[model samples]
Target: MAERGRDEESGKFTEEYPKEDFIKALKELESTGTTDIAESVGCDRRTAYLKLNILEEENKVESKKIGNVLLWELAVESV
Candidate 1:
């Protein structure tokens, strides 16, 4: 398995799930929650949530709250 955090040589934090992988996961799903994205990307739910929010800020993805659930999907302009 890959190391959870930090790269030995670069001394920078490593991502268990790369942002590209996260985007790909989002593309595969129509609309899904963070837990589902995390499972698809093989990362933790927290990581998925944070990354998704970042994407939202970038306008790469959009989210909607349905009841207690937050569903995320890629932005139309992003596709």
Candidate 2:
């Protein structure tokens, strides 16, 4: 579930989506762009990148640099 927030002054709505949700989204995404990750989780790009890096360190995700864009994918387990 995502936490909802609203600014009193600007009346802008914000959602603090859970990282666990992103993990599930990443697994379903399989392979996708960096922006896609953020969009999937309703989080900012920087946050998505940070989480992906953490996942990479945890051996849960993989990344590849293709030209200027970095592609991310779920790490597959051996049968």
Candidate 3:
């Protein structure tokens, strides 16, 4: 058990997402749409949409439709 715990602590079971990467992804998402955002972030389109929805619900971001595409952007001033 102790060996297993050490192995986990050694980064085998840890997944870290950098804040900078997340911010960059958010900016890219804002510039593009869900599909582009997913590609840029190295995630699936569905996951990208889900993340965008969560951010929107948290008032951290907003989305708008331009033509047939939906674009996301960070909310500078939260309500």
Candidate topping lDDT: 1
Residues 33-60, candidate 2: write the lDDT tens digits: 8799899887789989988888788888
Worst 10 residues of 1 by lDDT: 14-23
At residue 72, candidate 1 shows an lDDT of 95
Candidates in order, TM-scores: namely 0.82, 0.70, 0.63
The lDDT of each candidate is: 0.89, 0.79, 0.67
Question: In terms of TM-score, how similar is model 3 to the real structure?
Answer: 0.63
Deviation (Å) of 46 in candidate 3? 0.6
Model 3 agreement with the true structure over 15-79: per-residue lDDT tens digits: 22333444577765455688877777777788778777877787777889999898877778742
lDDT score at residue 32, model 3, on the 0-100 scale: 65
Q: Report backbone clashes per prediction.
A: 0, 0, 0
Q: Indicate the residue-level lDDT of 69 in model 1.
A: 97
- Deviating ranges (above 4 Å) for candidate 3: 1-22, 28-30
Model 1: per-residue Cα lDDT over 1-79, one tens digit each: 6556888999889876677887899889879999999999987899899999999999999999999999999999989
